[model samples]
Target: MERILREPLETYSTQKTQKFVGNPLANKLRGEYQRLLEEILPDRNRYLVVGSPGKGNWASCPWIAILDSLITDTAQSGYYPVLIFKEDMTGVYLSLNQGVTRVKEYYKRNAKNVLRVIAQDYRAKIEIDNEDLTEIDLASRNNNAKLYEAGNIIAKYYPADNLPTTTELIQDVRRFLNLYEELIFNDTQIDETKNLTALEKKQYRLHFRIERNSNIANKVKQHKGYKCEGCKFTFSSMYGSLGKEFIEAHHLIPISTLNLGNVQVNIETDFAVLCSNCHSMIHRLDDPSNLELLQKIIKDNLT
Candidate 1:
């Protein structure tokens, strides 16, 4: 684990970025490092362990992540625990961070603000014993670096000079993995059905649906631009930079009505991209899918 974390920090930037992927170090991160983590990952079957030197071009700060199957198998979208090297390679962070890609698609130029808001929300709600890490410095001004800095929920740092023993690293990883699973289980199965009347109950029922499937949302946005399908209003028109590419995906088939099992939502047909105002108003109707009725109400209400 130390070697996996150290080699990239020590050698990644020294090597040219374009050819870095073919390098042995990159191969080890992409292949061998994941196998070592596979051996240690809890309920190992539930995770798709992966590491990245970069996608097409080499990353300035490379990472090896333990991604959960329920949230996402890729580092591109869901939150996951990852060991990412700093830009300067002086240290690395064991960080619970988010995937910036989907956020970028949803918010376009305003993703940084959205990511920061989410990080703040998570920090406020979730409690980690001694791992109440606040901020991370990837030490670069790269776009991904900036996004990662905002996306970081919590982190533990290890300096390059003082890398821990493989066993210690393994222990830390396993403990963090357990915490990761706890976050997933808590978030994935939100049953308000089970009655709870405690102070913590409010926190338990806290609905911060942290990018559960922002990809689907992105696809909906892609199919229907940021304009409100119900009102033909675009957020960016009024709010400019703050509202660029902003819209919510409203389910044409109400989630409560649909069978959770074997139900597939087609991005092109099953969802409507509505501004938040229209999104809320659509639910007032008996059939939320009836955009025609929603439009008529708006037209009639105009004075």
Candidate 2:
């Protein structure tokens, strides 16, 4: 384990560590990290594992990021509960990374309240940057555990002698996400607004819906193959190589349930692989078109 932690730092001192997506060594290190996380969190299976052994850019320092599956989707719709291991730094950190996502501003608006909840709920000491956080915030803030990155706040969990157990770490993160859900995604006022047109309201609701869980989609495509889940239509087979490897990801879970915030998505159960035509037909209506329902429709048409 110490060797796993030391690998990136050693690699980065000479050059940036390569991307973790297909690297065996980097992946093994993440597997070890997952083992450590699972030992502490009983519900750890629900979380998707993500991040790289080190930031690939030549200028960036060595770091490992393990992100929650739901939040790791696209960096826009959900909050990423991250566990970061910095080679130069002594211990791992429990952080909420919204900085890389499109919703950084949304998090910034409620940062103060979010910090308060973290402190009151978990008894964890946290730090926040006083200045306004911008895109540059990502490059500038580092090494100083004293100031939390404002756009996406973070707190140290394993600082040398004061390493937190898995239970303590889980409690801290859960408390933080609960408060985040309450403050950000639970707004009912927008739905109740008296001023918007029908089309406008539709657009408003879409902000919560269109964010794709790519991890689930990619996993489904890899395991299930790129054929349409409903009709078994293979784009490549039909179009001769031009359409190879191209398929759409459809969310099988009902859309109404997504607004509840922090909902755990079961990749195997919640998504389907589809061709473009079937995907469009399924979502022709506002709600998620049911998989079984669509299958029946296709069967009937063929008959």
Candidate 3:
């Protein structure tokens, strides 16, 4: 990392001055440096490590990102833990960051603003490793650096002269990866704006958890009282006007497997009127169809 911080600056400048075409530094960043970082990971197969010196032109702030394989193979989308060398080569940042490419494409000239907004949204919900690292500084106004700074959800800076030991670096990466799993790859708790860019899969997955037929749902809710069957919690009683007639209709049987034979759903027998909490809890069960077991679990917890 120390070598990466120091060596790249001089090499980049020299190559750019001569109107460089091919990049040896890019090769090293993606190959050797990436391999070095990969060695520290607990399971390398779960991560996709990649580095970039620049694209067609030399980047003022080059980076090497460790991406979660399930979420993103490239840094263009989803979130990742990245090592971004400062534009001035004076320092580097280990950032838990968003992918700027997707943001830029969607938000265009206002991408920076949206990136900052999404970063705030991410920080609000998850447990952050570093409470102080809510933002980062790349010390340059380059487009990439600016986007990276705005996209930072949380970060720890490493000054060029005083970098951490390899062990410490590995620990930080592991901590950041854990956060990444919770906030980005967990496929649950995706809140805030559904229209937020770079989170198509997560947002859709959360929405797709229950494929509801609205007519059937309304009829089912009519048949069942507007109270949580699991805990007898009434939303209207708690919140008054805002929660009137508000209750979720949950299908006891898995919707995907409902097509077995010539299946027909009976609203009274197959549906449950649950509060959001109970509905979410039931989905975590191995067999959500077992309403008796779910009620027992919830009852035991209360006692």
Best by TM-score: 1
The Cα local distance difference test for each model comes to 0.75, 0.50, 0.74
State every prediction's TM-score relative to the real structure: 0.63, 0.43, 0.61
Give the range of the ten consecutive residues with the poorest summed lDDT in model 1. Answer: 202-211
RMSD (Å) per prediction: 7.5, 10.8, 13.1
Ranking, lDDT, top scorer first: 1, 3, 2
Instruction: Summarize candidate 1's per-residue lDDT along 1-303 as a digit string, tens digits.
Output: 567877777777776444754688778888998898888765666678889888777787888889865356568776788998898899998988888999989988899889888877665655676655778999988998899998888888999999878998988887777667556545544445545444323333221121235656777788888889888899889999999999998767643445422335677877888888997788666566788899898888885
Q: Compared with the true structure, what per-residue lDDT tens digits does model 3 show for residues 54-107?
A: 887778888999986544556897778898887777778889888899889998
What lDDT tens digits, residue by residue, belong to model 2 across residues 102-177? 3324445565445334433322223333331221122323432212243244444455446555456666656545
Tell me the TM-score of model 1.
0.63
Top candidate by lDDT: 1
True lDDT of residue 275, candidate 2: 83
What's the lDDT for residue 116 in model 1? 85
| Candidate with the larger TM-score of 2 and 3 | 3
